[model samples]
Target: MNIIELFEELKIDKNNILLASPEDIIRIEKQINVEKRINPDIDVNVANNLILALKDYRQELYFIASNRILYTLFSKKNYSRHHFPPLQREYDAEKIQSFINQFLNDDLVLYFDQNLSQNKFDMINDIFDFKNCFPEDALFQLNKKLNIKLDSVLVNLSQNNSENNSAISYVEYRSFYVLLSYFSSIEMDDKIRSLVNIVSERYNANKLSDFYTTCISSMQGYVAFDPGLTSILVRNREAAVSNSIERSSSGSSSGMSGKSIFFIVIAVLKVLFLFAKCSSH
Candidate 1:
């Protein structure tokens, strides 16, 4: 398997690794080192970068994932309607907002590291600098109340798919499809793999295009989101809250609880922190 494929395989178990025990972390490291030793040609740098893009920066990754998923779902719809998918369906922007809020909360450990003032407007703006997949003039009402500017580079759901369509494919963004599939998960929505393929076929970047096409071909085969993801995240959040409350009520050692939650949070957030450690001018 190529680097992208191998990283894809590793990405599948991100959340599992995120919540692993201390000994499990050690075992995982050993297994990974063993695999690298067995495969001399494996691009360890790319594999490590893929992990940074997919698993690290929990808040940032989810923010990007939600935007990209929303762009995919709502871009083609009538921006004036604001009904999300089907007009007759019950979905709407309010539900979307709720999902973002619930899913983006800290893993119940940020409060310890620092204060949680929760004003992410600046961070949101910075992320959009790298990518904003929303359609032009999309979510007009939603964007008006929210202080955010969104101009789409690619993936314009506003336009129908065709030769003239500039939506969803670009050389600079070629790497994103590979990362998105892993972030959303293959089992969640199989459409991701197809979307990755579509982007792969758009060889508009000249010489750079050939390099990316090869990368995409090597990375083929993967997948999702919908109301299903929203529901799943909501349930997970509720359960986490209930568990936290129970532990607190049980009079468990605060030291143990803090250590456990802190460990998971650091494990998940570490790579992204290192990835962006070198600030760009």
Candidate 2:
């Protein structure tokens, strides 16, 4: 089905849907037969799906839109004679950034040192010029927000990874691993593999390798967090809270009689703690 149909079928609120440009909406609308104009203020049901689709297809869309914008800019007669616009006429970085921020709101970054290959590990040192490229303040915020412990080893690894791989592919792999390392069990692995397979098939990939390559190449930055365990945490948040409340209530009741509630509370707290820790990573 078309995007609009999918959205309508899912009853997504239009306001929750953010776009980088009106042109983007127009383009998508043309590609898909949207029976009615999407009212930004009234639609929200499919916001999650929309966000997921956009992220899963981000690099492809980003590259396409960037190239298109560049082409449009250069296609004009005075292109080379003047400086580039602060932003392109049809590009809205803020809107895109907002979408990004919203997408990442529910997710956390996970790091894995052991899963990284040696060559991949070393390339991090060569690519990123720390002084010129990365935003120090943003990086600091990222570290603080995600509880990422920045060290020479991690920095060295990232820089080296950036240098060794092709510009497009390098960032893609890094993003993939950054998301992948969060999966800790065979079940999560299966989910990832299934999602990858679905993405590959949707994109009409001929081989598993090709599908994986394209999937990562296209969707790198769009993936804000590892959804494997975090999704479970989100789904169970209310239940977790309810269980805690129940334990607390039980504790209050038992404290007057026996130590039953105290043990139950401790057990519940331990489980909650484990869930939180797993979800956080």
Candidate 3:
């Protein structure tokens, strides 16, 4: 569908037409707010898809305009009260699904050139072996199976243009950090981290200590912060290691005893205290 048609189908504001026009960037600047007004409860991906569609329609100065569009869509004004997730593949399916489905409508439309039902069967079979499934998986896998293009038109717009707008570059940097924070929640995947680093370096935002801190904080139930805004990425790793070590030490699968558990808890608390004290410095 054309940009305007897609917006209409999605029930987004007609104001988005002005936003999608390539004549100027003014309309794109107001898009996030307009989107909020038109559908305050829209899903994050739907909002992202809309912005991407608009940028694609504008078709100007690829990366710069696409970055600007993303900035407009995900500014502090838009996302401070309501955080949207970055695209990441390593997340637990259920958690990722929750984020994806948060603003989703039951009747949300999926556009494709082929019937997706066939591949859904194979995907369901293959994914069950992993013992986990996400609501989006069936469709994503089906798209993969059918060679359906899941192209975002704006992503094509974000090509290297040589001419750099400092403002747009800054927005790109922010978007990269936001993406990093969103993806870090998933089980830390090397590929995802590498992508974040690439985007960070590309936007000259390699110093992302604060961003990591925010990501750790977003990891609910994990006391994963340091005063210097250093992340607990290692802490989770260490916990996993400790669990393995304890499992090995115990030898049997029955579980640890009350006395052993007490001692282990004490040791953990002491280690945490020591780590906290060391971090304070």
Candidate 4:
């Protein structure tokens, strides 16, 4: 059954459907025909089935649209890129609150409120907080906003188990790489190093080797470098060596020579450089 027929049978006004914009409605109409191709029998209860399917599709679209709106607002408030256009003047807090009241159900609002607390807007968790209304939807929106490809890895990582639920997921790793690329492009390697430090401490996963290997293997052909990522990596390694030296001095003397530390840092930096270069290629 077509979407129009299903809507008519369900007594739903196509224009007044909750949480759907005009473009979404048009896409829904097109998608219904596509869905019908999978079950073209058109049985006696076909309209009911179609209505159910369309409702599910509409809900999915609603989550996607809502995620995009929220992320856009968050980016505007936090990142505030000078090159990007300003958000619509109509999207102030009062206007957004009114829209939220009119459009979203209470359950969704509460979910968003709970998740918003977890978003520091400085790390991957800000984009993929599972406590959110729909974390998968939010991840998709973040990828769209950043123009990156990370959905497959994100899905896999979401299904895996981690200690303290704080293990670094593929989404987190890829986002860290992307952030490095972005900051490097803008000559902001310090920001990249700071963010990496924050994520490393927050997640506390002792799997840097695994993370590096997996990131390189998965993103080799799909990733691109910003020429600043190399600089970020070098600086990060230097900072790591400096911190190691400080800790060693403060604690027990392990007799680790300066030359040994220099070589170790170089080796680590070279590996990171290779990873970044391979991903970009």
On TM-score, the candidate that comes out on top is: 4
Clashes of each: 4, 18, 3, 0
**Which residues of candidate 2, in runs, are more than 4 Å off?**
1-92, 104-141, 145-281
Best model number under lDDT = 4
Per-residue alpha-carbon lDDT of candidate 1 for residues 10-39, written as tens digits (9 for 90 to 100):
443533433555566456455557777887
Tens-place lDDT digits, model 2, residues 97-193:
3433343222211111322332242222221222122233433444343222212223433453435334324323444434333323543333333
In candidate 3 the C-alpha lDDT for residue 237 amounts to 30
Off by over 4 Å in 3: 2-59, 64-233, 248-250, 254-281
Stretches of candidate 4 above 4 Å error? 1-11, 16-97, 101-166, 170-191, 195-208, 215-281
**C-alpha lDDT values of all predictions:** 0.34, 0.35, 0.33, 0.39
Each model's Cα RMSD: 27.9, 23.1, 21.0, 16.4
Instruction: Rank by lDDT, highest first.
Output: 4, 2, 1, 3
TM-score of each: 0.21, 0.19, 0.20, 0.24
Q: What ranges in model 1 sit over 4 Å off?
A: 1-4, 47-281
Tens-digit per-residue lDDT, 140-196, candidate 3: 443343222112211321443324322222222222222223223222222223222
Residue 141 lDDT (model 1): 29
What's the lDDT for residue 19 in model 3? 50
RMSD of 1: 27.9
lDDT of 4 at 36: 53
